[model samples]
Target: MPYVNIRITREGATSEQKARLIQGATQLLVEVLGKNPQTTVVVIDEVDTDNWGIGGESVTVRRKRGQ
Candidate 1:
């Protein structure tokens, strides 16, 4: 069995986007790892922007810096 974990900011993506991501991720796992889709586990974690950080900064801050 293969486990896939995906984390994203809570308010950014719509339900459809998340669904598509889950579907595509499972397909990718099946293609690359030869894992059975039924046996594979996919976990999506939705967190607030303040709680999600990268490169020692919050996601909101990162986006602001880029903009």
Candidate 2:
């Protein structure tokens, strides 16, 4: 079994987009690691911008400054 965790900001990502992400991750594991797609686990965690940080600043603040 292969477990993959993907984290992204809650920025209006659509269901179709999320589905594609899960599919793509599973496919990658199958192709590169010889994992079974049926057994692969993919999890996407959408976090609030304020809860995600980078370079000593929150993603919310960085976006405000256009960084």
lDDT winner:
2
- TM-score for each candidate, following the candidate numbering: 0.78, 0.96
Give the per-residue lDDT digits (tens) of candidate 2, residues 1-67.
Answer: 9999999999999999999999999999999989999999999999999999989989999999987
Residue 67 error for model 2, in Å? 2.3
How displaced is residue 66 in candidate 2, in Å? 1.5
Best by TM-score: 2
Q: For residues 1-67, what per-residue lDDT tens digits would candidate 1 score against the true structure? A: 7888998788768888888988999999999888899988888899988888988889888878882
Q: Tell how far residue 61 is off in model 1, in angstroms.
A: 3.4
For residue 41, what is the lDDT in candidate 2? 95
Estimate every model's Cα lDDT from 0 to 1: 0.86, 0.96
